[model samples]
Target: MEFVMETKNINKYFHKPKEFHVLKNISFGVKKGEFTSIMGKSGSGKSTLLYILSTMDTDYTGQLYLNNDLVTGKSQRELSRIRNKNIGFVFQFHYLLSEFSVLENVMLPAKKLGEKSPAEIERNAQQKLDMLHIGHLAHQRASRISGGEKQRVAIARALINDPTILMGDEPTGNLDSQNSENVFNIFKKLKEEQGLSLLVVTHDEDFAKRTDRIVQLEDGEIIAQ
Candidate 1:
């Protein structure tokens, strides 16, 4: 199977009064269209690893392959371009543009990348929103929507770019059990419809169990695959 994202000998460190090693020799692979989760305790560097895999942070020691392309030496400009075209990220806090409506919020990425015309982007955003079953809420301001609905809009936005891999960093961290389940259901919908590869970082056992594989991370390394 083709891998959508992979990391080999990934090591991330931070400098403060003392150097803190956040990720240590992390190596993993996400096959195309598979849903995988990274589970670890707090301060276990799961988020750090996710950011590296998603190409959100570049100052790490490792070889990362996204869609089989080596991403380590990619220029900032080129990395930004790759991230926009090939990757989608969801954070614990749904960072919806409060000023924009749900439809417009989902279209923001395409607009920033100048990937499509306004009318076309809007149409495509609407299509994804509808697929996520949130089309009726498109016109509402992002702040006005419930947490569950906001998460849905965020997922639709992530899908707007038609990315090959979607990475979520504790996407359900802030929601209640009910809302978390709802957010997770959207992931299932995405996997079924698009066969999109998913890499999720979470402490929630229930959410992790829903994925095709659960990887246990301990002390910045993969102890269980």
Candidate 2:
């Protein structure tokens, strides 16, 4: 089967206060349309591995491939372009621009990508918000929405670019159980109906259990899959 993203023999280290290895020979692949979760205790390098997989951290040794393209040694500019066109990320914190309207926040990435006309971008952004059931809040200030609504908005924003893969790092970590379930249901809906691939980092067991597969990490190495 083809994969949306793969990491082979990935290794990472930190030299800040002292040299410390974070990720060790991490390898995995996220299949097309598969919903997979990465789970590990705090400081297990789950987030560190995710940084490398997402192509945001280039200070790692590995063969990183996304959409069948080798991105391991790409320049920052090239990687940025590739990421804008291919990957969507949702963090534990919804990094929405508080001053912008929900619709604007969603349109930001699409606008930066510049692959579509402004009017087209607006239409696409609205469609994403509607798909997430937040179209009515599009004109509202991002700071004014509820936490759950904010996350949905964030997901909408992440989808605005029509990325090949959606990656989440503790996407529901800030939500209450009820809201977390809401977010999970949305993810499931997208995977089932839209056939979008997803790789999520989560500590919530129930959430991890619900995914198609679980990749567990311990001390920066994949311990189970």
Candidate maximizing lDDT: 2
Q: Return the top candidate by TM-score.
A: 2
TM-score of decoy 2: 0.98
CA deviation > 4 Å runs, candidate 1: none
Evaluated against the true structure, the overall lDDT of model 2 is 0.93
Which ten-residue region of model 1 has the weakest summed lDDT?
47-56
| Model 1 residue 65 CA deviation in Å | 0.4
Q: After superposition, how far is residue 49 of candidate 2 from its true place, in Å?
A: 0.7
lDDT of each: 0.88, 0.93
Tens digits of per-residue lDDT for model 1, 104-219: 89999898889689999999999999887889998999999998888888888988889998889899989999999888888887788779899999989989987999989988
Q: List the residue pairs that clash in candidate 2.
A: none
lDDT of 2 by residue, 1-225 (tens): 799999889999999999999999988899999999999999999888888888899998879999888999999999998998899999999999999999999999999999999999999999999988889998999999999999999999899988899999999999999999999999999899989999999999999999999999999889999
